[model samples]
Target: MTFTPTLSLYVARGFLLTTLLMLCALTGLVALFDFIELLRRAASRPSVGFDIPATIAALRLPFVAMQILPFAILLGGITAFWRLTRSSELIVARAAGVSAWGFLTGPGLVALLLGAIAVTGVSPLSSAMLARAERMDQSFLRTGGGMSSLAGGRLWLRQADRELDENGVAIVAGRPTAARPADPRDGFARFELKDVTVWRLSAGDSPLARIEAPRAQLTPGTWVLEEAVSFGADRMPTRPQRIELPTELTPGRIEDSFASPETLGFWSLPGFIEVLEQAGFSAVRHRIQFHSLLATPILALAMALLAAGFSMRHNRRGGVAQMIAGGVAAGFALFVVDRISAEFGEAGSLPVILAAWVPTVAGLLLALSLLLHLEDG
Candidate 1:
């Protein structure tokens, strides 16, 4: 209430410490839950190692911590403010002429700072670790061994052949030079592969021919191999101007096969978006993710403000149980809204920026309204 620098620092430190404690507790709980689920999955698979679950749990703690920030900030702010109120410290400060706004300012700013750190410092680390954990977990669940991960510059795919062809089956390996997502409207999710290597195997699993091309595109029914060089078992390697290799891989299948956007880091998102757009893909999912990361700090600040609004009033005027329940419910509701909006954003059902920020902006506005009403009344 006195608006003193020392009082503000004390409030900020108390709130931050509480938030960190809650974060630690929540992360440990999440890790435990994940470990139990992993163990249950490993029970049926003899190939899974005991160390794999532990490693996955350890690697995923960062992601869990990042996910819990908004909730931690809300709970921490509520705890700190409720303590101050019950102890009569806040009342005494108010009597001493400090406004509610003055005290809440420090906590609000700290929440914003925590949000910034979550996005810029923790997000990339968490995303990368989660990606690796998922790949390993998926492999153990599905294949029981070996890496089954897919996402990034290099790619390998087996061409599915339905018809009997004496020429043999083809294996495709290459760097993904470009991609065009299905323009369902146009019926094509065209892609360009660079440094392409193709091996046609005989019925006995022997290599029949090795074909290399500078570029290749799988169209409706054929692989349009450009500047292709073909080497067969019994003949000299021959260069072809353009060769059409039979294939059944569709654009939708190729689109579905790419790595999920979640596996990519926040720092790398912009460049990835550019490349995706250049390759003629929609890049909607990446754009949504990037915008969501940018909005995280503001979301935390909104949660803090909402918590303060619910917990800062004089206790004598209200039902303590109801107030606490209401505050928790509001925090959860915001989280649900944010997730639903993100889903809409990713699906392209809503405009990217709007989907990422609508819930956050709405929460902030509601908090501001509550604060203003309290200040005026």
Candidate 2:
């Protein structure tokens, strides 16, 4: 059967319109809930006024949009195909020797293109906004104001160096302030942490040496402290011009401590991963994130095809509810498997590439098999 370009464009136009409307509706609902949550958090902090929640919600909207894009595509595809089926337009085309696969090609490609645009274009803006929102939230509405210096962040990692002292405690504070750094450039994130405190403990975790430094930076395998003051158990407190402390923690690990992979844009992830692995930290999570983003376009296309397969049946042979339900169930199943695989990847039980790509491949194959039965059989 010859598939006409006119038909393809017509189908693509309808699908794109529906997808965009669905995106707007879903994005608005998400923003409303996020605003409420931010408002609740801002209640106790005087620095955050009523307007802060709105600002935070706006900043977070793109990330939320990215999260729900697949579902939006699914629903949009279903809506578009079902509308055509109900109006008998698709039936007419089918009667004229048009195949479901041919008719679906346009919408499938459109979905894939949208997915790519989301990952490449929208993601960088979303990442930047998300990072800003997180920082703003921490600054204004964070609980435990002064001692928050001691509180853990989302990227917190604890490394024990037995060689330094069995009972020694190191307190690292501050985030990396660097921006758009290349992988080989002093591992920019390592220089971002400031205000370091080290405590030397005796047999029972009693303090033996208390070192306070205004600025501390993590290097390859050591912490360089500037203008440090040391207070010993028996000796008088002494001022040191520079104190270099041996550390098992690497720059990669320190970089991982400040920001999550999602908070970094797609363009920065590869360089950041290199920096992470070079400094002796695990890059599994970053690699997983990168591969997952790389798979988004194909995943979106699969979702579109699956949605059409589920909802394109003739109304004369009803069961729309069941078909749509099955599609949603399949989507949720894919999500669960992806989460499980990611956990395994992060735990180093599974290879990063396998963990990231397995769910995507499985989803696509499953959708393709189901569509073959529905479309060809």
Candidate 3:
């Protein structure tokens, strides 16, 4: 018998509601743990109140929900299918000539819709909230205030000069790259900045001097500027072939100052990645995030299929609990594979596309194979 529109709607509604309910339950549980951790950290800071941790937890919930959505979809689909099978609704349809795939179509479409909404709508809002959360974290929780700023496709870094007893700022035209000869001074020339401009400020907050260089390298406790020109308040502009300025900044500190990939929205990532790469920074993490977002919908659909494959068996053939457990295990296995592939992708050992899409595609194929065996064997 053909699966009517009414039946499809029934299945779709069941899938949607169950998925939403599961998502809420999982997100709430995760948020509670996160809030507790934040609260614990806040306790050490006399200036922080309960409201600050609570606010941060609230802001982070949406991003956490998105991460948990796939498992919710899997469990929701399993519950939906298990219910239909136990009620003999699906079994009756099957006995009357309807195929498992017929009923699966509705849930699959709903899963796709959910995934699309998450990627195009929810991600942007969550990313914005996450960015705000990071700002609050840095301002209130971290020892240092903001140390870096990105504008007009340039990177700016703030540093304290202990040796000179002054504060300085630098603008970098491109990303920092590995410096040659590795700075024998301390092996600190791990990275070098390009098209650099440094500004030193006096104790009174006035500009003490301005230095510009085509290339600059970090060595132990100072910045070595090559072919630099210096402008000072009391002297005519002087051109120096090499100049060394005392600094407390290191390569690791500068890298840590950059914004994380998660703070940028999906729609904004492409442009941001372009600007980062143009400025000579590594965009690998951003590229992985973009590809992963693009693959979310397909992964959702695959999760639905896997759920159905595991839970749509006849009631007479028991082991329902075992089957459901298997589905959950499979979901976790997919998650582990995704993380491993992502690590490889970040390390440049795997292509970004394969790292992002391989697990989703493999899950879909495996689900199809299982369903085929059950339907025709």
Best model number under TM-score: 2
Cand. 2 TM to true fold? 0.77
For each of the candidates, the C-alpha root-mean-square deviation to the true structure, in angstroms, is: 11.4, 6.9, 11.9
lDDT of each: 0.79, 0.77, 0.81
Question: Which pairs of residues have clashing backbones in candidate 2?
Answer: none
**Model 1 regions more than 4 Å off:** 144-257
Least accurate 10 contiguous residues by lDDT in model 1: 144-153
- Find the 10 residues in a row with the least total lDDT in model 3: 163-172
Highest lDDT: give the candidate number. Answer: 3
In model 2, which runs have C-alpha deviations exceeding 4 angstroms? 144-256
1-377 in candidate 1: lDDT tens per residue?
34777788888899999988988887798889989988888889888889988888888888889888888888888888888888888888878888888888888889999999888888889878987888778667665322123444556766543233464466788876546666687577777788898887755567777889998987776889999998888757896769888765665445433656766778978977765553335688888888888998998999888888888777787776677678889889988998898898878789999998898999899889988887788
State the TM-score for model 1: 0.73
Give the alpha carbon lDDT tens digit for every residue of 31-128 in model 2: 99889988988887776789778888899999999988988898888889889988999989988988887788899889999999999999899988
Q: Give the TM-score of candidate 3.
A: 0.75
Q: TM-score, each model?
A: 0.73, 0.77, 0.75
